[model samples]
Target: MKLQVNIQILQLSFLALLFFTPLLHKTISSAPFAAVLHLLSANLRLSLSCTICTFISIFYYFYTRPSQVYMLNYTCYKPPPHRKCSYQVAENFVSRNAQFTEKTLDFMRNIYLKSGLGDETYGPAFIFEEDGVPTLNYAMQEAEEGIFSSIDALLLKTLIDPQSIDIVIVTSGSFSPTPSLSSLILNHYILKPDVKTYNLSGMGCSSGVISMDFAAEILRSSRKIQNVLVVVTESITLNWYSGDNRPMLVTNCIFRVGCAAALITNDPSHRRVAKMELVDSLRTHDGADDGAYRAAFQEEDEKGINGISLTKDLIRVAGMSLRKHIKILAPRVLPLSQIVHYAYSVVSAKFWGDESKPIVPDFKTAFEHICIHTGGRAVIENVARVLKLDDEVIEPARMTLNRFGNTSSSLVFYELAYFEAKKRAKMGDRMWMLAFGTGFKVGSLVWKWLQNSSQEFDNPWNDCIQNYPLKT
Candidate 1:
């Protein structure tokens, strides 16, 4: 009986082993495939998360980046439809007649006559009719009327609805506060009451770029803002000083009645005329220096003549100030190619101790054209040397100075018009505008042309192109 029971147990054990062996083999065979499937699932989840994060990062960058607006079109105020009349200057005007002594006349002749005002032999010429009253007040009135009319003509031609403009920037050197020129422009144009407006006064020749800088900042901040209208004019009539001082007499020779109105739009959607896309701007003030302030200042020495003494140091101060500004600004607008070349030159100069050969920055790589302030011949010459620029690069400035004298704040625009009229600017060309003002300030504005600008009917360059390559 015991032997039979043991035999039954052994038989049951054998049957169990046979049934479980195949199951163990199958489990071992599938383990590697299961491990691979689990690893793939984890990797897929990580990849999806990374993709979503990358999309969010890209979207954030786009939303926060500042959008650059190309200047769609711009129009300058045309003088008038009337034919050009012969304008003359009276030698003996009201305030100046009593003050014109032999010494004063000699000084005036030296300053105005020799400095290139038509011919002294032809006598002093003013821009008014002979019968017209020669008072500063009268001149101001005429200038105001002419500017308003020109602006009206421009507005009519542009056909831009007054209500659509987002901002109006007005700049003038002579008058401020009482009857602000900006208010006069806004009221005459019948713009909206709440429309944003800025009146920049006391800035002198640099005001135009200052106004442009302000307008650019506004556009940079707000997406809703589009159109910006800038008016730049100099009221020489109001500030005429009849003093016997040489500085006071300097103004009589150079300044003339001139006004320019430009319409700049931030709307990229509109594409009709040449575009000036703003790239970079810089401003430097050396007001703390007494020499700079005295270089261009108004001094009254008990004589009623309010003379603005333009010291010989003015050009030097301007050059120094410009160098300072460029040091701060070059890294911003200059391309990496230029920066690399400039750096190599500097390192070579330093390590090699090559004091004889100075490294000058190659501005040609940065700008195709340059418009230096048309202040005077000396100023233009000095700037050209400092930047190592050629005469062709500064021709617009020289020509504008010769034709229009010093239009102050609007000088750069006139230079730009000259470039356009000559068809010197090509698509994708870059321009640099440099200006100096009363606060002993130097400012720069950089722009890139969006398209070629053909000669427009109203362009000032049209009339002067024939005479140009002028005797300057």
Candidate 2:
């Protein structure tokens, strides 16, 4: 119906142009003006006719195109052999440390044990090596190893040649080294020279979702089918804190090394083998305010030691940012009934002079599954409270946190892998991925499962799927 309207508009516009050009030509009697008008009208009519035919052709070409964007496949990095940081080993590493005061050591231990982290989470740089001194060389090596392995697995699983990727996006919140992460992928894969590449830094943990939105928008606007490879990872090797600042101390306790790679494409041929279809995405930022901006800040401490400081206001900021994000997102995804109820509540509260706050819409009605960022226990709990979610709904986030720790930008993909491993996602089910980043930014992506996913060999949970949902 819409296409027909556009076609009709083109036809009408062409007829008007053709009719006016000749009528104007006839009205001009002077030789000079008449010839000029005649030439102008002839060119105008010809151009209009060409444009009309072009529009018709282009519309017909697209009208027959497939209607889905596919996430062909994705893989989360499983840290190489012997890189795992179990609780006992982490405690021992702390015990052996001469830098932290006993009081600070105890605090770190408390956060580590209770941070929803498990024994399998991996650390970067010298933290995992036999010797515990970090070096720039070692940090780069660790980053490269993680990126290569993850991307290799993703391409292998998808059976896509590296040369086939047309776009590359790499995001790491804290660490972006020389020959940028995207450049590293280009050099490693030897992709085509014309491949467009983007390196996004300082976008925080929500960058994974941001990258997805970035790729989707680009693919949607492009005339030709294209594949975008998005690599989401964080650099823990160089960001490690040796400082005693309490806020900075918490980062050391919770964050671990992780990376994830995904292949997203607008190519209709790949939809048959894709896991999910990108449905919708939204992002909201609250960093304009000082408090929200400083909630999770990175800077050098008094001694000039660099690290991210997780201020006490972070959880509060997260809650506020999420509230703002959902406000815009609800209208896009929520059903009409729920939307009407929310509207009535708002109207009643404002006009009726009711003191009660407006009702929170039931997001459960919008999506079958939700992948909330595993920022920490507090962040997860706060999101659950705001959304009024049940324990089952938050299980993936909790389990992902426990198993992988805070993987920075790549966290949500790990949670999605968990859902696939558990076989919780089925064809036609809608999944909402919500992630919070250090810029105090909130991002959301909605996806519809294209097919039922079974356990894949590269699944990080393959070894211990049976042991999940650990009692808190």
Candidate 3:
């Protein structure tokens, strides 16, 4: 329908232009404009007015159309072998630490065993140090390593010059240094002097998708903003919980160090080489609900040591928020048949008010690949339940959590890497990224693949991709 309308408008525009151009010639509209008007019939003047309106309308329609945003390429930071923290190494570290009590040790051990994190999850410098200090230097070092490594590999893969980046956005859940990660990039790379930079913090795991949404809008905001460089990383060295608070200790058991860098562009010339095109993005904030806001909050314990308290109500809050989120999102992306069925089911349930089974729109019908945030085992299962997803649909997310643990904002990107490593994503596949963060924030990004993906040089799962889909 839309294509037919555009074709008709274009034909009308061409005819209008052909007819209107001759009226402006000196022969018709020179100093003898009144004489020319006297020579013209009323029908001719009316035709001229109608033709001019058609031309102006067509011009405005094309002028206001939005530019398409594409992800040219992206790379995830692959930590060195020495950084891999085995289950044994983690157990020994916590057991030997003097700050932990017997109770705390047991709690952490239990959580670690059940957290779905594999032995190879990466850790920052602080964990391997003899003295085990979460110093500002070590935190900064971790951030620099992941950020620089990701950007270096991304630039190499995209074959795009650093100077071509028009905007840079850096996001971390809890770490924000004085110079800021964006400025750090500016100092390291000789980028364009007028490049715009933005640093965002405290948004937790959903930051990557949110930042991508922001970058897409930036690309659409102006034609001069051709490309955006987005770097998402987490400096977990300092955020590692030292206190014995059981809820806080979950961080120590599951969180890991990682980063991802992506180059997004609105330049039409790069579309052929781009990996995916942005289809739609959605974000929801549940901060108004106190239970949601404090579900995962950072606070100092009785001992005055800072740590993020992963409250017991977190899973519940997330599930409730997801239901509300999909209610709004389903209509935009679900197939027409699914939409109709879902609408009827919803109306039937409300009208009957019985204890019938709850209905959920089959998101699998809309997305061919899903990068569900690897927040934790429970978080993944909750999302699976809410979306009515099968285990196969969430394999990447499960494998990512086992391999990389919770890398905060970059978790979904790691899942994306997993899809590439598995060689499952093909050109034209519809991809979905769903992420949840502190403040009970939920974000979803829908994408259409521009080309098939192959193993990347910086793919974190390169050596171990074959070992995935481990026994459930």
Give the number of the best model, judged by lDDT.
3
lDDT of 3: 0.89
| lDDT (10s digit) by residue, model 1, range 1-472 | 3355455545544454454444444554578786654455545544554555455545544454454655644444334323122123434443246656787776665565444333211111233445433465665564576468656656665777888777888888655646677777777779888778888887878887887877777776666648888778776655666666666677766655556776776665654453678877778899998888777886675665555667778889988888878878887877898888777877778898867444567787788888889887777888998888898887778777776667677778777788878888888888898999987998898888878866776676676577776774
Candidate 2: tens digits of C-alpha lDDT, residues 325-428 = 99999998999999999999999999999889889999999999999999898889999999999899999999999999999999998999999889988999
Ranking of all candidate structures by their TM-score, best first: 3, 2, 1
* lDDT, ranked from best to worst: 3, 2, 1
Candidate that beats the other on lDDT, 1 or 3, i.e. the better one: 3
Tell me how far candidate 1 lies from the true structure as C-alpha RMSD in angstroms. 16.1
CA lDDT of each prediction against the hidden true structure: 0.68, 0.87, 0.89
lDDT tens per residue, model 3, 208-227 = 99999999988876756488
| lDDT, residue 21, candidate 2 | 53
TM-score of each: 0.82, 0.87, 0.90
Best by TM-score: 3
Q: Tell me the TM-score of model 3.
A: 0.90
Question: How many collisions per candidate?
Answer: 4, 0, 0
Q: Of models 1 and 3, which has the larger TM-score?
A: 3
